[model samples]
Target: MLTPLFERRIDRMNRGIAEGSLTARLPSGETRVLGGRAAGPAAVIELRSWRAMLRLALDGSSGWYAAWLAGEWASPDPVQLFALFTGNRAALAVEARAMGPSLLAKRVWHWLRRNHRSGSRRNIRFHYDLGNDFYEAWLDSRMNYSSAIFRGAESLEDAQAAKLRAMLERTATAPGDKILEIGCGWGPFVELAAREGRSVHGITLSTEQKAYAETRLSGHAGARFSLTDYRDVTGTYDAVASIEMAEAVGRRYWPDYLAAIARALKPGGHAALQFITYDDAMFEAYAANVDFIQRHVFPGGLLISESAFRALAAENGLLWQDQVNFGASYAETLRQWRERFDAAADADRLPAQFDAKFVDLWRYYLMYCEGGFRGGSIDVVQITLVKD
Candidate 1:
């Protein structure tokens, strides 16, 4: 009996014939072609065997589509279908067919409006309010969620600690100095600065994070965690830093975010910012995936070009003192996260949702990120600025 795989290949071939010509050109310039008829503006795709098509569809395409079409891919939760489906180009083509670009952008914009309110209390709470324990499970104990600095390090933990150390050193923390931290997740820097005899004020949109931070810093004098947006902050600090929280601040808010920092920093004060971003020019191939991320993972997040970042900083009276790329470090960091998540995923211990979402999400997040990293589509930048 003919297998299902053979039948699917035949079906795809038939579809190709109906649409346009499918042909193969050998390296020696010999050409073999197959088609029902020559039509206007023929769509020509290389002839692929049944097995090759199946492999490409399942592995190269989105896992969601793979699961749907072949039932071989894995997903922990049904809710994950949206995230997975967004990675499939074919599915996006279908979507583009049903709804025009303007309509799709409008829908995405609506989602953005709901989640990306710069300096809004609701916006911060939407993402940061996820309990501290949940984040702690994956992130380092110090809760450093930003990219790790892996220079001259043998392990991820050591490298992350080094990155934190590098951040503090670059900021030039001093005793009794006033410091500001934007997007202070769980207050690691706040606690560290206070311990070193610095007066620290940290701002976050997430009430849950602020509450945890308050409890963490209660006994530490000269340290305060405010449940406020970064853009609304007004104060002159001697030093400022935000670790890995820049991704949450969308590209449209980059100028505003930096301006706020500049306004809050005393002249000669230092600011350290660490973020993961993609080069805008390299995004055409991944537009569908980008849209999916903005909708699901981070609403209103913008991956601006490097030139745009420099221009914005210049406009805001901020001078870029130092910048480092930890794109490779992120690969290792994410790998560790995947391993830890997989190792710890026990049905009895973790919430059903957590376990259900872990596998497919982690795999998709890792593999696709690895591909992007290899392809130079993404980057991680650590920029240190001085108020001019």
Candidate 2:
């Protein structure tokens, strides 16, 4: 009952395919030719197996293809499956190279200003901002919306709760303290903090999320949501925190993002930001994974090198207080999300394509990220900072 909107959108996406710029790998480990219809909008590409097509459609790789095929996975987009098989991975690679660290930072900054506004942010809203009801089916009750922490939990709900509690504890916040949550998702932190008698102010880019948070916090006088970019926030707070939203801020804006937080915090105020980052020194092993995320998942996102973070923090007058690594926790969290998504799909609350695509993408995303962490290719770092 989704009407023709999803189908129409799929059609439009296929039309972009007809323009013949798209390319994807086949199960045979070779790229295939996609033929446009002589008179229609759809293009056809043949694969040897439905499993192959599904992998191409879902995971784009055969390694974990069966995981999604057996009805065991989920993610935000189904088209990523199509993207893997029929979209242009080579082009994505080229673009990823264009964003390499060796490239001048100023040049990267200029490119970000030009392309940052409409890339991943639009894609995120197109897929994620549909409604909280859609996400509620799969996510934990807290609706944290960022990656869950999977430490010492036997179940998904328990793990996500741990993640939330960890956030609250790490900040070491007190009741009635003023806190700023950058890129607040659904206001879980605001709700949690407010419940603890803290005055919480949250800023986010998603209007749908802001609206949902407002409703979620309707009775909490200590919590407030604002539809403002981080750069525009001007005030003093006891603490500052951001969860998983720094990727979209882009490396070009990292300094600015840190600067804004530093400015917004009172002198000696503590800040904690948790994010997924690539170990650029290990580029060969993990760079491809990062490229995939940029192309199909978070288009304009950037993963900062730890050294880059240190230098940026120092430059912005932020004293590095402490840093914690939670990569294994994130991997466990993704696994839980995939399971929940599959369950939701089985119950018929989630669309088939959505479930399949997410499973495939998430398997790759999670495993790759997990491998990065284990192999030191990437890290999920919670860096505590203080204004000097």
Candidate 3:
């Protein structure tokens, strides 16, 4: 089955890929050649079966994602494996057909809770509530799940602090200013701000996150954590900050989210927000497809274009004051995380699943995201909006 499929795909690529063919080890431990000339380092795939190959052919990229998640295939180094895919993404995307969801994954996602209060709780729980220990093993000390701002070869820990510090400076939080952080994951930024003598009220939809943050910040004089949605907050603050959480608001609730931020702020308040973004040209395609990230990584989350965000800020009476891009940093961050996750099974932090699915799937997801950043398919930005 792979014979014909590989033949078809390689032929379409027409780049003398046979010279860079991959060695695939089948479930039966038999090896076969696959792929065209790969761009970088050599890699191996522990194939699932001939049927899996057929599924890969019919299902598109998501099919491969599902297969990896099910332990259908593996590569000792996922970066190398993912490189093979990204190197050929252009050719493959050109030939990619409008195949429906490979395994009804999109349908399941469609039925899940969305951006309403209860829905937000469920969505937040689905990801962040996995376990504090699980995240602690990979993320930085403060449990930053978002991208960090690197100042050239700094460790992730330092980068994370720099990221937090940068946000602090940009928002110009005073020693006693009142701040509200929507979707504050584990309260890192809240704690950071509190340590500097600022008062902070952090809202989060994940009960586990609120619980952890509560215990951590209980003694701080000006720190408070709420297991609540952004829309439910009651008080006004001197400033507002939400990092990488806007995506979870969903398209239908974007207005409400923007409004909620506006309502939480006092007059002349400022806002600092960090979000993932896509190019304007791909917004249409992004809206149409419930792609692998939507189906598996961030259900109900949708990326907005930077242009759209600027427009929204203007309409909401916030002047777009500053914007910065550090997408390449995210790729390196993922690389650091993959290294930690790779050692998890050995460290007994997150043991290899019985089927070894979790490790393979996680590695693939990281690299897949890294590929997006590398290919300019996605970006990360920190924007400051002022309401003067």
Candidate 4:
């Protein structure tokens, strides 16, 4: 039965939908249409139980995810719903954010998972150590886990190669220049550098990544992989390339991350970095509460604030340059990945260790991120920071 309090809560959420429309079917066979003020993506949600709304009201995205896990709600196309919420996030404000004890508890738990030296390794392992074979089942041939830059109708593999080339070009390394790749996954960038006759060294906190990278480049005399923390790196390189790794560094360690880059680069050397960023306007609120990604997908992860990150780089004697935003490409990349993942899952190619629930969670994670990029609130960027 639908209670008056739950109905009122649903009404409040509807009022905040400044853009897009949602048609929600309640358990009592009632349908409510919300937010037709403007033309936008329309999504339909079926509420199996009113507790789903209550969960969303109290726990925000994380709670809503829990409700989904419990079969309290269903959506024909969740991507539309996610995009709608993210696109109208500013107008929705606190309506979709955690509150009360849930907020406080999640914040404390997130603090505990901060990316300190040891915690960094643990956190990396939590996501990346799912085994190389597991990722290989779904990822591209190059095993590029980050966003790929698509040009026209090229394949995902070609797009990923283009992204790698783009990042390397930003570094402008000569044939003999030594290149350091921070958070190198599966040796794609390092192998490319080594093939170009550059002395390439790749570092990662994930044991699985380091092992896979080293094995992948075993025949290349100029390529090496190390399990090392960025803060502890102890050498100057002609160029540095860190692809989509900065998000793993928590907000408290932004300075440390920039300082490490500054210390590792030779004078006038360039550091090409690919990082995810939150819209400047929404960063504070996003940081204040634990979102679905932070709570379940990537522990200790926080998206960058471009202004603050650039300021930190400047403070560390690194001049920011050639910033490129390719968030739409990321959305497409994620969509492709999800398609591949679903194919692999249907074929039973995924590892036996990851059960059905884990698979569903992974699917949701990819969808959530894809929608985030599509909505324009979150973005992925490639930028060069030159050492002064």
Candidate 5:
């Protein structure tokens, strides 16, 4: 059903794949192979209709997702397909990115949801307020929502505990030290710190998170949870820990985020941050258009540019140090989460309000993130920034 113009477009996209192999079954009952020039992950995609190609040509990742939802395409292993596209993003040019009206519309929508103070609360609630029960259905015990460090860990719970301990170690806080946790999701780290007799204050915008954290740590007098913004934080702390939270702070607020960290820390205090970042080469294109994650999963979210972030930290009197990259571990974590989610759905453990479409969307989201991490274009890292 593809016209000559669409056929040429597909050929152009296939030619750009310099590193991997993609076996595409076109809607016209023809098969085409692209990108066998070098060794990489092999992915196969079956186009059920020409509309799939139209969607890709028009809307990029978001459009491709819509095509899948509408049954225009199918892939046995979508993770590899996503990995292929993400890995060769540079070579693929604009083939996998939003363009024209779709690009402009998505960009405008994302800008409206930008991480301004008011919009931050709305954005945070949009994702995290899906209810604690929904998360508890799939998330490991202790409810850590970020990446888990997998070194020497046997299970997802253990890996999450290891990640928490590692981040706590980076804070370098002794007993009785005052610790501030920005964007404390479900109070895992705060409870850990409080159990060690450190005074811990956790701030978040999600009402569910605050309620859950407060009830979870009710017995710990040293642990506190509040609905607070990072920009409005008061008092200096001995150390700070913010895990996977800075991504919510858009590029426009990077300086403000760093400044808040700098101002909240006492002299010589360390602030541990675990954040996701786009490779320097990919940041320009990524920032130029709204991505699937930004458009659907986490509105107002923008991955950091490590170089730019580090420079901003330095400018704000925070010396970045002891960086660790664990993107592969994150990819593994997402795989596990997806499995758990599927199991929960099969067992009817997910909330009733979340229908089949919602479940499918979340599954796709998990795979998309995992593939991005595996593709090496995106990465998750833990770093300690010391206030000088």
Candidate 6:
């Protein structure tokens, strides 16, 4: 139905291709290579309809994703598929000249996403409650839902362990220290802290996550988890830590979230947080787009921009005295996950309840995120917030 728009966008993109910017191979066997030979990532993307392409071209990130989920298009390699889009940024710029969601629509959506406690719980459950067995097919042994820190090229398992050790080291727990962890996923941090003789109190809103963490840490004498909201934690602690959880707090609640951390920490306490961070430009651009991740992956989540974080941290008196970045590792993490997931699906080992649509949805999620980190569109930071 939107063939006219699709044709027009491709025509504009063709101009950029003429400048040696990109290459494309359509399913119809037509090749478009602007200033150079028609070499591909040499892959074919089967666009099932111009309607899908129109949605992609106009609806921003969420557009293509919804189409893909609806079986409107597919590629042999999802990772390479995203690389094609991300790699051909110039061509997309040409195409997007006057095509995007309206500001009024964005404002309406932003206003709708309030991220209250119940909504946060629903969002967490929506993603994490997909079942542990589903995750076990792809994730490392510990099942960290965030980026794994890699030292050079390494196995995902080793990289995940390395990441855990980094967080545990940064916490620098002492015997009998009362450490509170917000947004603890599956309780790896709690187990590690318990092993160090620290009494670890961890909270998460996901009921499945809470059950899994409790079972996983059952043998650890000092580990406990509560289905508690972050805003309700009143106990002071020797240390507080959260990994990749702050982003779900919503930008509007950044100050209150930071204040919660500040309140949870004892005087002179340390807080270590791992954040999937965005720079100013990337954050602004992303905030303006139809985020497929927010709609489909983490419903109530929003990215943490370094600028917003700094401002809120300053306002809340939470200062990052130490920091490290290992964002490049996330690409590899997603790569291994996608590989494992594909292998498992090929083996038909995924849950019988999972259909092809679910498979495609997850594939897009992993590959899409991989593109973000690989292209430096986003970064991950480990910051030690000091309560000064």
Higher-lDDT candidate among 4 and 6? 4
lDDT of 5 at 247: 96
Candidate 6 stretches with Cα past 4 Å from truth are: 1-8, 14-21, 27-29, 34-48, 70-73, 84-113
Displacement of residue 298 (Cα, Å) in model 2 is: 1.6
Regions more than 4 Å wrong, model 2: 1-124, 283-290, 351-376
> Per-residue lDDT tens digits of candidate 5, residues 287-372?
99888888889999999999999999999999999999999899999999999999999999999999999999999999999989
Expressed as tens digits, the lDDT of each residue in 1-388 for candidate 4 is: 5588888877876887888899999988999998878877698999999888889889999888889989999999888888888888877657678999999999999999999998898889999999999999999998999999997788999999999999989998989899988899888999888998899989998889888888878998689988889999998999999998999998999999999999999999999999999999989988998988888989999999999999999999999999999998999999999999999999999999999999999999998898788878899999999999
Best by TM-score: 5
Best by lDDT: 5
- The lDDT per prediction is 0.62, 0.62, 0.74, 0.91, 0.92, 0.76
Candidate 4 lDDT at 76 equals: 92
Superposed model 3: Cα runs more than 4 Å off: 1-6, 14-53, 69-77, 80-91, 94-98, 101-108, 351-355
Model 4 alpha-carbon drift over 4 Å, by segment: none
Q: How high is each candidate's TM-score?
A: 0.72, 0.68, 0.84, 0.97, 0.98, 0.88
How much is the lDDT of residue 64 in candidate 1? 29
Give the alpha carbon lDDT tens digit for every residue of 1-388 in model 2. 4324433433444444432322333334455444343322122332333343223333323323343445433323333333332232222222223333433342353354322445435645754576777678778887866666665747776776666677777666799799999989888878888899989999887778889889878999899999777888988999998988777777667888888988998988888788877655543433333344554455566677777778898998889866788776775676566667667767887644465566456546644444334433456877788888
Clashing pairs in 3: 17-36, 17-37, 20-37
Clashes of each: 0, 6, 3, 0, 0, 1
TM-score, candidate 2, is: 0.68
TM-score of 3: 0.84
Q: Can you write out model 1's per-residue Cα lDDT over 100-194, one digit (the tens) per residue? A: 45335645664555434553565555555666766766677777766677776567778877887787777876898998988888888888788
